[model samples]
Target: MNDLVCLLFQSHVKMITPMLLKLFIFASVYQECHGEERVDQPDPHIAEFEGRSVTLQCKYKTTSPQPELFWYIQKENHFPKYMLKRNKYGGEDNDAQFQERFDSNVSSDSVPLTIKNLHVSDSAVYYCVLQPTVTGNTRTLH
Candidate 1:
């Protein structure tokens, strides 16, 4: 009777061991797939025009909370310069430059830039920016 009981216990352990290992492996693969997605994920879209409004979409992912949104401009071979600060919901703060040439707003997830009177000189690169709080990372448009 003791021999039969021992045999049954051993078989149960053998059956459970593989299932536990498979569960662990499945969890690891799931984590790996999701992890790769979070690294430097790209935004949905960006648009530009010579004499019309432009909208730049920004997206980000982090381990912690979401951060502020911003707009910036950059010159050739120069560091980025701040243009406007954005509310979390995408409203522009109306900086002097932004108020002069552009009307802007946010709709919870996007920054749409409207150039009231587009000009040839307004053809420089513009960006919609996002800062993710937990990662302390910044994303920009070109």
Candidate 2:
């Protein structure tokens, strides 16, 4: 009886071990192959405006397990504004700029930045940035 039990246990472990190893390797490869996505790859169209408000849109490509959405604004020869509104994990941080003249909605798949009460200063080009949960490159717009 003891010998039989020992043989059965050893067979079970051997069978499970290879499966576990394969699963681990597959998960690792999937992670490695899919990295942070490029939100503004090949550069999106530069929106031109002569109106009170402007909406800048970006099309992104990502296979991220988790994604965070953001919108940034930068005037000619000016630094960028890191504004966060929504994320994939459901965290919302309204930036000062957004608090003032911006209203937005975000999701794991898409981010839309709407600027209202636009002034001449706001005439500059805007960007839609997507920050994924995974540690990788940051995607930006112009």
Candidate 3:
């Protein structure tokens, strides 16, 4: 009876060893690739007059499982202000201060932020940020 029980336990461990190894490999690869997102915003020095509109171009490349896009603005000495973001769930958030003057458009590989009726106080740097969208873990043990 003792030998039979020992044999069963050994078989159980052997069956699970391969699955555990595969899960570990998948987790590491997922972590490494999820951070592979890059955004490009050219025309670092853009100038415009008061009451005029300015559109900043931003393009991004995402090679992760799930990705979300966002836009932010940073003033001279202030922290980045969350202007707007489009989540994976199709929800959108537009800042109250930028309701009428600020607008954003998202395409397949591009998302540009546009400001209308520009004011002197709006002289600041804008940034395009992309992040990984998290859904519930889909991994299941067979």
Candidate 4:
């Protein structure tokens, strides 16, 4: 009777071991798949005439207490260039080349890019990024 009882216990342990391992792997994958930060650019395409002013909208969600937002511009056949950065704590930095016309203000849920005196050369793809970002695929306009 004792032998039978021992065999049953061993079988139960063997069955549960694999199940526990699978559960652990799943939890790790789930944690990695979900993130606490995201950014949205509602208007994928925007058009404005030369010398006109335009505001590009960017909305973001983050769990961070002090969120920092960034703007990047990618012209045709070139790498993405950093345009500016704005923090929730009233800090800001703008690249020298873009200082004259490019500006943004970080609000509670958004940081909009305002371009004054738009030029033909200003035509390009824009990106809004959040700090501590996750790696993912992004599409660029061709």
Candidate 5:
């Protein structure tokens, strides 16, 4: 099933920029698929026109039992700004900045970040950190 998930995701990437599967991890605590292998993570870059909106997708191939995903934005020369600091369940968090402009949602293994009312200040490098709910060592695709 994990392999199938990776396959389906790979096929989906065709419509956009091609994706390469560069990481494979074996995690034991994940109940989704202990021995299953997954791949074809999300693209690392996103370009959006000013005043427009964009959905940043973070997809990872893993059966991690309770992966709590966090999205962080780091502007050049500035510290990383975090979204969804506390309330992390579903729906948009009512407290970030600028009228709750940033909204996030998660799917099986992907989290799409939607930033509204884009501005020059909103431009930055975003990162998705998925730390399993269980404690364990971590490594990412190279």
Candidate 6:
């Protein structure tokens, strides 16, 4: 009985060892592919007159073929609010509150937020965000 139990345990270990190794390799490759993503807001401060238009620039570096870029606005003492998101494949969505005045286009490496008829309320910090694509299966078995 002791020898039988030992043999079963060794076989189970051998079976699981390859699966663990494969998972480690997959994780490393996933990190290597998705690790170097970043977004840049070139101008920390921008000034514009009321009732005019201003464009805020955001640049990004990503390995995703269909990168999704987003814009957010944050008021004083308030959390960031999602304004819009633009995809490389022409997909986009804008918040109802920003539909009229906020617009953007996704280019090869940058997305610029253009606010028309700027209001005093629009005087807040704007942020550019990047959403990286998921390349592999992300589900876990129970």
Model number with the top TM-score: 6
Q: Pick the winner on TM-score between candidates 2 and 4.
A: 4
Candidate 6 per-residue lDDT, tens place, 78-124, comes to: 55579999999999999999999999999989999998877777877
lDDT of residue 79 for candidate 4: 53
For each candidate in turn, give its C-alpha RMSD to the true structure in angstroms.
23.9, 23.8, 21.5, 23.0, 11.6, 20.2
For candidate 3, the clash count comes to 0
lDDT string, candidate 5, 1-142, tens digits:
1111010112222222222211112222332455343323376555656667767676654455655666666555554456652113554442445346687777776676777756666766665656555456476523
Q: Which regions in candidate 3 have their CA more than 4 angstroms from the true location?
A: 1-36, 64-66, 87-90, 136-142
TM-score of each: 0.47, 0.55, 0.65, 0.70, 0.57, 0.72
lDDT of 3 by residue, 31-116 (tens): 46664566677656677777777787877777645567788766655555688876445667798877888877777677777878
Residue-level error in angstroms, candidate 1, position 66: 5.5
The worst-scoring run of ten residues by lDDT in candidate 4 lies at 1-10
lDDT of 2 by residue, 1-142 (tens): 1111000001122323465557545544654676546564233443333344545555555666666666655555554457655765667788765687676665545666666655555544455655556556567522
Candidate 2 residue-wise lDDT at 70? 68
| lDDT, candidates in the order shown | 0.47, 0.52, 0.64, 0.71, 0.51, 0.73
- Mind giving the per-residue lDDT tens digits that candidate 4 earns over 11-77? 1223234655575355446445655666778877777667778888998877777788999876656
> Which candidate ranks first by lDDT, i.e. highest?
6
Model 1 TM-score, 2 decimals: 0.47
Better of 3 and 5 by TM-score: 3
* Clashing residue pairs found in predicted model 4: none
Please give the range of 10 consecutive residues that has the lowest summed lDDT in model 6: 1-10
Clash totals for all candidate models: 1, 0, 0, 0, 1, 0
Regions of candidate 5 where Cα sits further than 4 Å from its true position: 1-41, 85-95, 135-142
Order the candidate numbers by lDDT, best to worst: 6, 4, 3, 2, 5, 1
lDDT of 5 at 49: 61
